[model samples]
Target: MKIRSFFTAILTALFGIFYLPSANAHALYVFAQYDGQVLSGKSYYSDMAPAAATYFEVFRSGIEEPILTGKTDVLGAFNIAVPDAPNTTLKVVVEGEEGHKVSVVADRTMVSNSSNDNFMLLREDIAHLKDKIYLHDILGGIGYIVGIAGLIAWLNSRKIKQGAK
Candidate 1:
């Protein structure tokens, strides 16, 4: 009986861990572009909601210090005039509530080659697809846990029956 209770407790804990909503559910996402003069982008959550008033920092590649810092507007949009640094890559980080944060690297060549509107739309679609994949992975993990738990229970039951015989 004691061993059965212990197994039950372990299985319960495993199920709780797998089913509970995690911080990543509201993961932050930021997308930015450098247009030779200004750096602009939007910050959003996994649910497609805008991450308004989030703090942002812009750093040059390979540099620890941030060259510019600001917060997103009510619409989760921000624009910063980048210094005249030709052929430089910049990293933009956006941090939202509850330590949720994301970053994107942008270069002049990359931005100039893509249309901003279309790129932004594509990015949003990609985010949604990633969220779907994450959910499927979680469900798959839960299935594996259940399968292992069932196998353990079956083995324990068989052991008790053999002992009685």
Candidate 2:
């Protein structure tokens, strides 16, 4: 019986390893920003591979027709100057191979009035803020674990007192 049970557990583990959907892939994403006059961003695959020479289409807000079309450079970067765009937002669509297309939108809100050289510094600041928030979330999760453990201890103590009575 013991050997049979061990064999059964091994088979279950093997089946779980083979049949379960455990493989995870990072999702493809794009981020674009406007620098008062130009829109620019990089295109990348889920695996952090550069999407070189990818064709992109730009559409204005609520416009069915694309206003501009272009291709990325070897570095997977594209920049377009829209000095007189009437709309406040621009959408960039990258048509990737294997039907892995992605779209990103650039808005006027990202266009700071500061000097052009400050953009990289500003991006770093935003990244730091994200890190702080992530840290805060991790601390909150620890607090929740402690709270649940305390509750369980209190419940067990109450049960012990009833047994003593």
Candidate 3:
């Protein structure tokens, strides 16, 4: 019984991962903004994004990893900035609940940059990784465990019926 429950949990987790794939890839977004650079983050959305993603990530222009990543506030927007955009492309990467990654860009220059960069860093952004695990794989192999468990349960029922007969 314990093993059976474990397998069920695994199956549920796996289904969750494969559940959505369309929003995984991103094209790009172009919007109007002042020529002035502001560390202030802009509102973004995954509305048309894949069903699996829960939040967006903002990656600084040259940084290998994202400077920050997280779910948006009620507005589906995040405000952030690197030390300066400096006539460079600012990257905003969106990560989904299911582990999909996508990015957008915001360009800016030093002359018009915002007054405060620290105001947006109230707390650091965290990555979502729980979606990667599938417990179903551990309870047993997909074919062997599920098939054997079903057969055993059936056989036990048959034997009980014969005894009654």
* Strongest candidate by TM-score: 1
lDDT of each prediction vs. the true structure? Answer: 0.78, 0.69, 0.48
Write model 2 residue lDDT over 1-165, tens digit each, in one string.
Answer: 954885687577546545762542334455567766787776766545667888988888878998889998986777888665664678888887667688878745455566754674465345334433243664576578658867987999899999999
Candidate 1 wrongly placed segments (more than 4 Å):
1-25, 84-87, 107-115, 132-135, 154-165
Highest lDDT against the true fold, candidate: 1
Per-residue error at 12 for model 3, in Å? 29
Candidate 3, superposed: residue stretches over 4 Å from native: 1-53, 109-165
Prediction 1 global C-alpha lDDT: 0.78
lDDT of 1 by residue, 12-125 (tens): 765665666452356787777787778888888876788999999999977899999999999798878987686578999888999887888964535455567786667656
Q: Any residue pairs clashing in model 2, and if so which?
A: none
Using alpha carbons, what is the TM-score of model 3?
0.34
Number of colliding residue pairs in model 2? 0
lDDT of 1 at 35: 76
Writing each residue's lDDT as its tens digit, candidate 3 over 91-159 gives 665554434545546545335245433333331121112222245654456668668878998999999
